[model samples]
Target: MNTPSPARWRPNRYQIVTISLALAIALAFSVFAFQDFRQGQLAFRVFNDEIEVLTTLANIQRHQALMFAQTLAWLDDPAAGKTEIEKQRTFLASQLRVLRPLVANEPEIEQRINNLQAALQEYDRLVESLGESPSPQARATARPQLIELLRRVDEALVKRAYDAQERSFVLDFGNLLRNQERARALLFGVSIAFILLVLFASGLYLRSERNTFNLRQRQIQELQAAVNDRTRALELAAGVSQRIAAIREQSQIVVEVVEQLKQTFNYYHAHIYLFDENRENLLMVGGTGEVGKTLLERGHKIPRGRGLVGRAAETSQPVLVPDTVADPAWLPNPLLPETRAEVAVPIVVGNRVLGVLDVQNNQVGSLSELDVLLISTVADQVGIALENIRSNQVVERLLQEYQQLIETSPAAIGILDAQTGVFVQANPQMLEMFELTPADVGQVGPIMLSPERQPDGRLSQEAAIEHITLALQQGKNTFEWVHHTRSGREFRAEIHLTPAPNREGRPMLNAIITDITARYEAEQQARRRAERETALNRLTQAIQGALSVEEALQITARELGQVLGRKPVLAALQSTLLSYDKEDQ
Candidate 1:
C-alpha cells in the first residue's frame, strides 16, 4: 500500500508565479476589450448627434423654399390683393431666418441662405416695377415681363439650393449611420469573443477543482483505512492486558483494570457496576480516574428498559451509545458530565447476570470491540466473587435465626445431671427470673433457690429438687408449683421434666418451666366474680318471677344492695323482656 504524503505540501514558488501570470494576462485582455467597446459606442453616439442636426436643417430649408415660391407667384398676378401678397412675404421671411441659423455651420446651408436673400430682392424689384407703370396697358405689359423674370430666378435658386442640401444630407448623415452600425457590429463580436474566452477559462478551472476534490477524497479514504488498522492493533493489545488484569475478585481491582486499559489506549472516564439480586437495575460499584468519586457518590442507577445500561442488561449484550441526546436509550448522567458516548457490557456468570460494566466519554463513538471483549472477561470473575459473597451471607443469616429462635422461647428450660441437681443450661428469661445473668446461672454446683420461699407458702428449693429427681427417676413427665422469684414476685408454673436417657440408661432431667403467673391471677379473679354472679343471678330470678313491683324491689334491695353495700333504686320496666336480667328472664 502506498503511504499518503504529509499535509504540509503547498503550491511551489514556480506554480505560484505561473498562476499569477495567468491572472494578470486575463485581466489585461479584459481591460483592453472593454476600452475598445466603450470607444466604439462613443463614435456611434457622435454620428447619431450629427444626423439629427442634419435632418432638422433639411426640413427648415425645404419649408423656406416653399414659402418663397408662394410669395413670387402672388406678386406676378396683376389682380393679386395686397393683403395676400403681404401674408406670403411675412411667412417667407420667417422661414428664411429660421433655416438660416439652424444650418449656419454648413457651407451648403450658408450658400442656400444667400440664394434665398437674392431671390427675395428680385421679387421686391418686380413688385416695385409693376407699381411704377401708370397706364393699365403699360401695367399689364410690364407685370407679365417682371413676373416671368422673378419666377424664373426664384425657382432656379430655391430648387438648386434644396438639391444641394438633400445631396449633402444623403452623403454626410447616411454615411455616418452606416459607419455607426458597422462599428456596433464589430464591438458586439469582440464582446462575444471575450465571453467565450471567460467561459473556456472557467471550464478549465472547474475541471481542475473536480480533479483536486477526487484526489483529496481518495487520500482521505486511504488515511482512514490505515488509521482503522492501527486502531485495531492497539485495541487488541490493550484488550489482552485488560483481560489479564480485570480477572480480580475485587470490584475496585476491576476498575483499576479499566484505568490501566484506558491509559494504554488513552480513553476518558471508565466505570463498572454489578447488578444486585434483581437484574432490573444497575448499581455503580467502581470507577477509575478523576470523576470516579463523583459517580460513586451520585449512585447513578439504570432501571430495566430505561437507558443504554438498561437496554444492555435486558438484551444480555453489549451496547454502544453514540449520542447522549439523540438516543432515546440514553439518560443524562451528571457524573459522566457532558458525556456523548458510552459502552456497557453485561457481567454475566453461568446463566445469571451479576451486573454491568461501563466505559464512558465526552466524545462520541469512543468504545471499540476490544473494550467490549476485555470488560466481558472481567465480568465473569466479578460475577463469581459476588455470588460467593451472597451465598456466605445467606448461610450466616440462617445460623443467626436458628440461634435467636432458641433464645426467644417463653419456656424456661434447663439441662441437669441425672444423679445430681447440677444446672447445665438455662434460657435468658429463666436466668432473669432467678435474678441471675447467663454468667451466674449455669454451674456444676448444687441447685439452689430462695430460702424464704419455703415459709412464704411457695415451693421450697428442696421440694422442687425432689420433684425434678423423682420425674427423672420414675419418668414422670410433668408437675405444677407456686414458685417465688428472687425479686419477691410469685409465679404459678407447670414444670415438664423428662428423662433424657443416655446409652447407659442413666438419664438427665430436661425440665421445661412455663410461667403461668397471668393465668393463675385470672383464675382467682374468676372464682370471686363467679360467686357474685351466682348471687346476682338468684336475685334477678326472684325479681323477674315476682308478680308485684314491691316484691321485685324488696328482693333486689335485700340480695344485691346488702351484699354490695350500695343502695338499690328500683324502676318499673315497661316489660319483662326489657328488664336487665340473666338470659331472657
Candidate 2:
C-alpha cells in the first residue's frame, strides 16, 4: 500500500572502500616500477659512457705505438722520419686534448691523461733534439727517452682499463634488461589483481541493487508519454558529452545543454547564465521558449549576490526553491508567472565560479534537491569541456608567438642537440654571423666550426664541450668562443647558452651569440701601445747615462728600431756637428 521511492540511488559504502584500497595499492606499485625504470636508464647511460672513454683512450695508445714504430723504422733517413713523426705527434696531442672533456668527471682519469700528455711532449722534444742527419750516438741517446715514453703510455692505459672495468661491473647495461622484465611482471600482476577486484565488486553491487531497481521500475510507469519524451532527450544528452570534448564553440555548447535539460526533465523553462569578462555580473547566454528569447534579446543580466542565480554563483552551491511564491529569495519575473518551483546549479571550474544553470517548473514542489544534483552533473561536464578548449587555444597561440619571436630576433641564435653535440637549428642571424648557409651548418659538429685552438691556448673543441656541459648541467653559461669561417677567417664571439628540453623531452642547448672581434682587437691594440710607451721611456733614461752623444744617439736609434718592430730609425749628424738629426728631418 506504500509508494516506493526512486531506489535511493547511491553507491554502497563497503564496495567504495574496497575499490579505493585496491586502487591505492595499484598506484603504489606503479610508482615503484617507474623508479626502477629510471634507475635502469641511468645504469645504461653510465655503461655507454664507460665504453666511450675506454675505446677513445685505447685508440690514442694504438696511434702512439704506431707512430713510435714508424719513426724508429725511418731513423736512418732523419728528414723523412722527422716530418712523419711531427705530423703524428700533432695528431696524438689533439687526441690527448680531447680526453680532457671526456674524463672531466673522473679526477683519476684526468690525472692519468695529464701525465700521458706531458710524456708525449717530452718525446717530441727528444725527437726534435735529434738533428736532420744524426750520428749513431745521438739516436742511441734519444732511444732511452723514447722507451721511457712508451712505458708511461703502457702504465696510463692499463690503469684506465682496470678502473673502467671495475665501474662497469657495478652498473652494467644488463641491469636495464632485467629491470624491464621486472616492470612487466609487476604490471601483469597488478592488472590481474585489479580485474579480480572489479569482478567481485560488480557481482555484489548487482545482487544488492536488483530488488530495489524492480520496485522503482513498477512505481514509475504511470505516464508512458512523458517516459518516451524523457528517454529521447537523455539519448541526445549522451551525445552532448562526446561533442563537448571535441567541439570548440562556447555558445553552441551551452545552447544544446539548456535545450536538453528543459526537454529531458519536463521543466517549463531553462537557461544558462555566464559571468561577464569582468565577472561582476552574470549574463544570460542561452534559454528555452519565447519568453526566454525576449529576455535574452533585451540582455538579461543578474548582478552578484542579487537573485537566486547570483546566490548560487557566489556560494558555488546549488539553490533549490519549492513554491517560489512563498520564498522572498526568489525574484519572480512576470514573464514566468507559472514558475512555482526553481533550481540553479553553479557551473564551477577549479575554485572559480564561471556561471549558473537555472531551471523552472509550473507546479509547486516539482523541483527538489534531486533535480539540483542532476543539473550540477551537467554543469560539471560543461565546465570540464570549456576548460579543455580554453587550454588548447592558449597553448596554440603561445607556440605561434614564440616561433615568430625566435625567427625575428636580431642576435645570432643556435640550437644544439644535447646528446650528440651537433648544431641542429641555426637562425638566419646565426648563419650570417658564421658566414655559412643553412645547408653548410646543418648536422655539423661544434668542432667543425671552430679553429684548431683558441687564442687562450686551449683546444677549441675541448673548450666548446666544457662550456656546453656547464650549461646543460648547471642551467646556464656565458663564455667567449673562437670560431672560423669556411675561408679561414677566425673571429671571437661572446656565447650565451641556456638549457631547455626539446619536443621529445630530451635536453637541448639554446645559444645567443654576439660578435666580439672588434672589442677584442681594440683591447690588443691598447696593450701594445702601452708596451711601446714603456720601452720608449726606458730607452730615454738609459741614453742619459751614455758617455758620448754619438754613442747615445746610436743606442737610441737601435732601441727605437727594435721597439717599433723592424722599422728603420736613422740618426744622421748635421754639419753643426753637435747633435744627430732624424733621417726624415
Identify the leading candidate in terms of lDDT.
2
Residue 69 miss distance in model 1 (angstroms):
99
Worst 10 residues of 1 by lDDT: 568-577
Each model's C-alpha lDDT?
Answer: 0.59, 0.71
So what's the TM-score on candidate 1? 0.27
lDDT of 1 by residue, 1-585 (tens): 999988996888876765676576557657865775686577567546444444434333333333333433343344554555556456557656655765677686577568667766766665665563244433423333343334444355555655566566546645544654554455445444444444455777656645654565466466556546655754555465445433434655556656764666566767676666665677877777667767778786667766777777777898877666778767776656768778887766433566677767677766667556556645544554455344334434533543454478665666566565656667776776666666764453224543445534765666767776787566455766666665656667777776542324444665567777788889989998998999889998898999976578677767776567543333322233256454545
**Model 1 global lDDT (CA atoms, 0 to 1):** 0.59
Task: Report the CA-based lDDT of candidate 2 relative to the real structure.
Answer: 0.71
After superposing candidate 1, which stretches have Cα over 4 Å from the reference? 1-248, 278-280, 368-585
Clashes (backbone N, CA, C under 3 Å), per candidate, total 2, 0
The parts of candidate 2 lying over 4 Å away from their true place are 1-270, 278-280, 287-300, 303-306, 314-317, 325-340, 348-352, 360-367, 370-401, 420-426, 435-448, 456-461, 486-489, 541-585
